[model samples]
Target: MMGEDADMRTMLAPPMSTPHDAGRRDLEQRYQRVCDLFPDQRVEIVNGRIVIREVPTLDHNRMIFRLLLQIMAFADQRGWTACNDIKLFLGTQVDRYRPDITVVPAEPRMWDAENVYADQTLLVVEVVSPSSRDDDNLLKPHSCSLAGVPLYLVIDPLEKTARLLSQPGRSGYVQQDAVMLGELLLLPDPWDLKLDTGKFLN
Candidate 1:
């Protein structure tokens, strides 16, 4: 038999959470530990804390569906792939963020084997909720900018508006356009995609 330390190492080798390590693990360890625990749930690591929110509302999922269709079509045209509900890890420099949708390269990388890295992230779309307003707006823009994510689109159905930010830099995106419902947002090249908001208005 191995020593107690070696036994502990072998026990926690896989990412299945146990009752013992529930309360005192660090942020990074906690994040990895919950990977498979909530396989069918929406779990996120926010500000060094693990958060589990209620299942998204129908309207939320509907908005996500509409935007996802657009992104998928756009990516298909460019021969790229769009994944929904993927966690975009920005390394230790920035915390993790689970966007409603993320557009990435066709090929996978080591970093993306589990969580998709921000460097591989081309575009991210977030459908805002009342509970997540600050996160979807303030926190995400700051982190995505710091991580060099090219485009960050925030859609707020409650506000009947959308905010598009680009040109990520240390301070944040240099350009920002606040688009009202029904107004078209033409994403910059190389995607050059146009987002329609008519349905979101009605």
Candidate 2:
């Protein structure tokens, strides 16, 4: 069963108390300070909103580790690598995300020292947390699609399923496919890789 900590991790901060634009910079600065104070947590600006997240649970980290192991060799063969927690700029200054796993070139030409543009990513993945169901299934896919990320994967342990979104369009991904955790998920085109979801831990 889901726990209270999971719910707390997904809590969205209230809207900025000050006026828009006029206080955006200040708000960002304050959030930056919070990040500096708590180095272990993740603080993100999502479409100009501040979203703070606690460190991943042990189960969460294990899932990411398994994915990295499977993806590393394939990515290395093509001069690409898989990573996590790297800030990704989503076509705007105030919109950024740190996907659970990202497939990127070994030597990415970054947008900045601390960020990589979403367009530079070959794929992004997010493992669903209890309170993040909607954001993981919808908001992030839409944003990543608009930012031209080639593929987006959403793994929901609660549902024991994985959903892959691809064929990006102005609105969002043009195509989507889903399968149970025990099935193989085929990545189309350029990737041509199959993920053995049977190994994923729920």
Candidate 3:
């Protein structure tokens, strides 16, 4: 039995590092350097490209703050944390995201280092800006759905609407609900909360 265990351990040991491994590590270090150089902007890897997002406008910040205030109390009651601009690891192929707002379990077990797995998040909210309209409206929903995120909310100031996507699956969200700004948005099961969007119109 001891001999068998030793053999198994040897088999499971990490393989010898290759040139590819060194290259990957060097890329990671370079990415970290870029992030350090631009601490004020959002730097991400998307589709194997390094993208830097400019800081948001005041109106955008205010809108997120309004939504955050509403979600904070509810999340607190449910042992979830509501945060803005946190790193979210989307998938294995060099994709990272910083959702405008994210609701996640407060427990450390749900987190992965400094990044949160999309499948473990309770909700992800994206407030659209001119530069990110396509990504926020189309690409994000698809990625989040594939990652099994339960809920995704899109607030579009340009459209003056809010959309809630639910029932994530291999294909995408099976259900979607939308309302104009200033209307009440219903968050379904597991949330069962009503969001008052009256103040969002400012």
Number of backbone clashes in candidate 2: 0
Where is model 2 poorest over a 10-residue stretch in terms of lDDT?
A: 13-22
TM-score, one value per model: 0.82, 0.84, 0.83
> What does candidate 3 score on TM?
0.83
Model 2 alpha-carbon miss at residue 113, Å: 1.0
Clashing pairs in 2: none
Residue-level lDDT of model 3, residues 92-180, one tens digit each, is 54467788888888763334666888888888999899988988898878888988889999999999999999999989899999999
Candidate 1 is scored at a TM of 0.82
Error of 2 at 129 (Å): 0.7
Return whichever of 2 and 3 wins on lDDT: 3
What stretches of model 3 exceed 4 Å from their correct place?
Answer: 1-30, 108-111
Say what the RMSD of model 3 is: 3.8
- Give the per-residue lDDT of model 2 (tens digit) for 82-190: 8777888785335668788888887776888878888888889999888678778878888888888889999888898989999988899999999999999998877
Q: Which residue runs does candidate 2 get wrong by more than 4 Å? A: 1-20
lDDT of 3 at 38: 95
